[model samples]
Target: MDNASSQINISFNFISDISNIDYKKKKDFSNVYNIQGMLNIRIENELFFSEEIALLEFYIQVKKWLSNKFDGSFYYNTIEVEGDDNPLIKFVASDNNYFISSPWGQDKVIAKAKAESLIESIKIFTEDFEEELYRTYKLNPKWYI
Candidate 1:
């Protein structure tokens, strides 16, 4: 689905920026995964960012776009971030000042679909997130590979 190489650069840029975002600190609470194919993407940046409300808006946008492209598939079914306690990305936002890393993601691929469908889903998903680069990656997602 992604014949052009334009998306690679965009996706990389978005992933690289996650560490810079300063997530809120709190215990595990309720952040609604109100959409289909909502997966966790863990990123670590050296520079800390401010204003999670902006970040939250970015996330919602990313999820919706990804869902449309992948026909409803989420990444990070099991993800590991770059700077998490482990290489595997795990993040849990409790409030506005603390984000915790936990190795609790599962390693499951959807069993109901054919391998062809999975491949198509991944391709579309990749492109979808890529579109968010420069435009709005925060509104984009870290939909795992």
Candidate 2:
């Protein structure tokens, strides 16, 4: 049997752009409408999965950003925010293959605020990583998108 956290490090590099629809928007018969509705539902599901993958990618990238900033060693599928009084930000893959929580906030702006807050509050810093990490703050979060 596979481990519970097996899905955490699993990347979805094969997902196609679900937004690239060939369908045209037009008035159609009721029956066609029903079929289109069903297809739309499927498309929505695909979009959801795509979003999930994107968010997960963002999380992983955040870890890399942290590592790059602090010159900290990187580990596979491991997340850590080191500080004696730092907020609890341990995110690991669960048995369900999803992260139990997000380190970043609901959106990019919130995520940036969270990062900034952590940087200011937490004393965890390495001489090598500090400069790089601070530079990341100047970058637009949209770059990750």
How many backbone clashes can be found in candidate 1?
Answer: 21
Q: Which parts of model 2 are misplaced by more than 4 Å?
A: 1-8, 18-51, 55-60, 63-145
lDDT of 2 by residue, 15-127 (tens): 32324222243122211112111000011112111122222233334446565663432222322334441222222323222222323322211111122223322222222
What's the true lDDT of residue 81 in model 2?
A: 38
Per-model TM-score, in order, reads 0.26, 0.19
Residue-wise C-alpha lDDT for candidate 1, range 35-107, written one tens digit per residue = 1122333222211212112223234444554456434323222122244323222122222212322343333
Error of 1 at 85 (Å): 12
Native-structure RMSD, model 2: 18.5
Q: Which segments of model 1 are wrong by more than 4 Å?
A: 1-112, 137-145
Best candidate according to lDDT? 1
